[model samples]
Target: MGTTSDQTAQHEGSKAAMGGLIVCPVDLDRPGLRVLDSGTGDGYWLQDLLGTYPRLVDGTLVGTDVTAAKFPKHGAPQPISLQIQSITQPWPSEWKHSFDLVHQRLVLGACGSFPHATAVRNLAELVKPGGWIQLIEPDQTCGIQDGPAMRDFIKLVTWVFERMGGHARYAYDVKRWLLDAGVVDVEERSVPNYLGARVPDADLARRTARWTADAMMPLLKYTEGHDGPIPIPREDLQTLVPRLHEELLERGGFYPLRVIYGRVPLAKE
Candidate 1:
């Protein structure tokens, strides 16, 4: 887990690159519409969506996570409710086939605790027939021009996540998961999250790099339960932070973010 500041920085970086609250086209005016944001960190994405489509105020909007301490107070015209729930477990029976739009972003790290297929199937079960599901995750396999330190960092982190029963590179498989879960018309859009100081938007890139470095700090200290500590030392991680930034500054250095979405098939389908 990362600090609040680190998460905020990551959100800002993602928002700058992704261009909106979400990439999927939602019909805010649909009757009895309901929206659910699984792993809704700080509720920013849901807030942005509600802010953009004020008409959704009439519908139910819920954000669920393992904790509600970080959810923002909702004074928006439509109330955004926060629920404390874990994505790995089965959702409430009432929630099954209940939402018009289900959104989850950057939850791969947490979802890695369970089988990817099971986690995704649980999310898919929350959508109503013909509703939409949108998932966004970083393609861990696709970092650009990684330096030796960054390379080592990736290797270490990947190993740590796998040891914890999670998949670090799950983003690359999201579309297939949705499809296997019976979603239709699946669509995928990949965006380059430019990092490093040489990109056109260098300020955002720098902040993103810093956030990435900060987020990885915990993994540096992580140890598999019976195995000794992860090989990377704290000092090495500290040194790698600046080195990562420097690497990103080189030409064509960026991370790829993939947004994959699909619609729940209508019953007749």
Candidate 2:
């Protein structure tokens, strides 16, 4: 999942299916536009945006991650910068209420390490008044109609995330959190994503399934509580992955992806 090729493909695939990067519909040509992508893995999303909206090269684009090691080596156009920072922690004081757009995708793992409310508030704090904050995350609980193996896999995923203080239901609760943070004009949409080649976009579905299978390995191997050296055991994955992959290839097997966006209320004049 850390590979540049893999990240790039994921970014492109998601963009193709979910529409453009930011959902708030801001003019890309707007001057002094500041954008922040928290947990910006591989910086692919920001890079794509900069490439597509060349005018944004003059605006400030920042990508933050826990480490800069996996950041794309090729320098982006001017005004693009990368910082090593944890999204779960208190952000720089200067950054508070500074960004025109704050985006975070698939950050459940990192955000789960801390209080969900705190994390959501930290992300909201970065948006300027009337600016937008967007979040995209998968519902890890289960697919639309999972088979035995797929069900088991979902259970394992939930167990692991819960053990690590994360949640599979974070997507569902994000809207409420945004509302509490004084965000307005909140809107959310969910896309049911098929894991196998049974969908119209067969290749995309299959590739996504395979990518998900590949990503689940390390997660399954995670050790938890004093139960055993191996939490679920590696052998289980060896048997489960293939079966789950096959299950996904069939009809009625899909996961839900939630996209939530809201605007920070403008300050009273």
Total clashing pairs for each candidate: 1, 0
Residue-level lDDT for 216 in candidate 1: 61
- For residues 43-77, write the lDDT of model 2, one tens digit per residue: 77787888888888778999989887877577544
Candidate 1, residue 115: how far the Cα is off, in Å: 1.3
Candidate 2 weakest lDDT stretch, 10 residues: 1-10
**In model 1, how large is the Cα lDDT of residue 201?**
71
Off by over 4 Å in 1: 1-6, 29-32, 73-78, 142-144, 224-235, 245-253
lDDT of 1 at 13: 68
List runs of model 2 lying over 4 Å from the truth.
1-4, 199-203, 224-234, 246-253
> Model 1: which residue pairs collide?
112-166
RMSD of each: 3.3, 2.9
In model 2, what is the error at residue 218, expressed in angstroms?
A: 2.0
Cα lDDT over the full model 1 = 0.75
